[model samples]
Target: MNVTLRQLRAFVALVRTGSFTAASRHLHVTQSALSGLIKELEHGLDVQLVERSTRRVQLSEIGEAFYPWAAKMLEDLDSALRAIADIKELQTGVVRIAAPQLMACTLLPDMVTAFTRQHGAIKVRLVDCAVEEVLDSVQRGEVDFGIGPERALTAETTARPLFDLPFVAIFPPDHPLARLNRVTWKDALAYPMISLRGEYTRRLSADLQAVHPELMLEPVHEVAFMTTAISMVKAGQGITTALPYGLSIIEQGQLEARVLDGPRISRRFHIFARKNRVLSPAAAGFCDFLVQACLKQDWVRLPEAVSR
Candidate 1:
């Protein structure tokens, strides 16, 4: 009814050592204290648990039956505590993250690789979906957190700025835009643009309208993934726009990227998580590692106005 772990431990220790002096020594407590704990346990259970004498001690009928259960309970509790300690130390656990396909392919893989190298036992599970799906994944509790450009926050989600980066123009080496020392939105818009469809294009258009009302991104082709846009650019179909983090993909596609200027617009990326839920130790550690990793990269800059 009112049994305590201390009482249970004393009972088990006495049974194991078979003597009051040895049990108290093992528990680092005085013999009287150990005797009191055993008495308390038996009193709470309303049963005699120990047959005590001057030379030896042994379990009564009920004590023998309860000893195994108490020992097993303590063993299980110890194992659980050890597991939590391992997670806190980042020695073992899994971190689930969701991001846009481009970032999943370009930025996240390298970051995850670096993190795993440092925390060899932790596993990072990355979910790569469409740009619009990043927030959806977070809202649905499918991931520990989601990373992408800022979006309209829902009531169930919270956003924290990760980094802010200006857009860059991606074009083939031989393209006319590639020759320009400084490419502006106007210059890039002059050509047929290949843009990501859905919220990405909508947001870019809105941002452009806020800066230069007359300039708009009317892409010749609209696709779901940045990889597709890069493929189109590689085929000389059209130039595309991306953040600086996508430089690896651009380079791999045999395309060059120039920073966009002339009313330069930048997008802020954020880490999105469920509003009321707490992140696991592994997830929180991975998030911190990601922030530090971004800070080290020249391409990723935390705006002075933004704070964690």
Candidate 2:
């Protein structure tokens, strides 16, 4: 029937304490206010919930039957509210993010590890997909946001530039290019280049081409993944180029990495999210954390880490 929470609270307090004075004192409300709430509850429910006397307070038969349900309803509501508060405070929740395969393996894992170290209660999910798929996932609202190269966003999306990572050449220790502290496009082209048959190679070709129209990068081998290209390079197949964000992986492969010069091009990393939507606390916190973390990255610095 239209019973109010305050009325239910007054009824329960009076029944538990067995004294109007004690119930009112427990509720920190005036005795008359407490009595009126119980009366409203009874009127609203059309039942005599309590028998009030100057000496004692007692629940009627129907009131005793409803007590458990009323108490449970209040308890559940309080629990739900507490859960919402916890999510808002970042004490609990999950953050879903989409990233290109390279970043998912390298930069994203580092950022996730750093974030979770501080906010252990929050779980982070990374969807490692192709470059186009990263944008598609974000556009479809499949994840909280996407992190990848800057691209033309749909009207519904927005992007914030996180950092720019320069291209670095990686090769076997004894490779000729490895002898140079810094290599140029011509220096790398002198050797057979092993490259990924992916967006990165395509983007690099376009960027370098813009600087010199006739420049040609004929790879001795093109593979579908960076790791494959890296393996080939480790076998002394040829040198390959990639952004320095994941230099650690190159090091693990026993390959020497050096900054690439000539045109001094770099790829810009951006954080993508829906334009009009609000990010949950965890997602927003992650965006901030990622930006800060990238700023601290040695490779993200320009003119110092690499030629450009």
Best by lDDT: 1
lDDT of each: 0.88, 0.83
Across 1-308, the per-residue lDDT of candidate 2 in tens digits comes to 88888988888788778788999999999999998998888898888888665366667789789889888888898899999998888888899999877778877887899899988999999998877688889988999999888788889999999988667888787777756766888788888998877676787788888997777788989887677788788787888888887666666538777777887777788899998888999999999999998888777755345332
Q: Candidate 1, overall lDDT?
A: 0.88
Instruction: Report per-prediction Cα RMSD to one decimal.
Output: 3.5, 2.4
Question: What are the runs in model 1 whose C-alpha is more than 4 Å off?
Answer: 301-308
lDDT minimum window of 10 residues, candidate 1: 299-308
What TM-score against the true fold does each predicted structure earn? 0.94, 0.90
Q: Write the per-residue lDDT of candidate 1 for residues 187-291, one digit (tens) a residue.
A: 999999999989889988998999899998899999999999989888989899888887776554387788788867888899999989999999999999999
Model 2: how far residue 59 lies from native, Å: 1.1
Count backbone clashes in candidate 1: 0
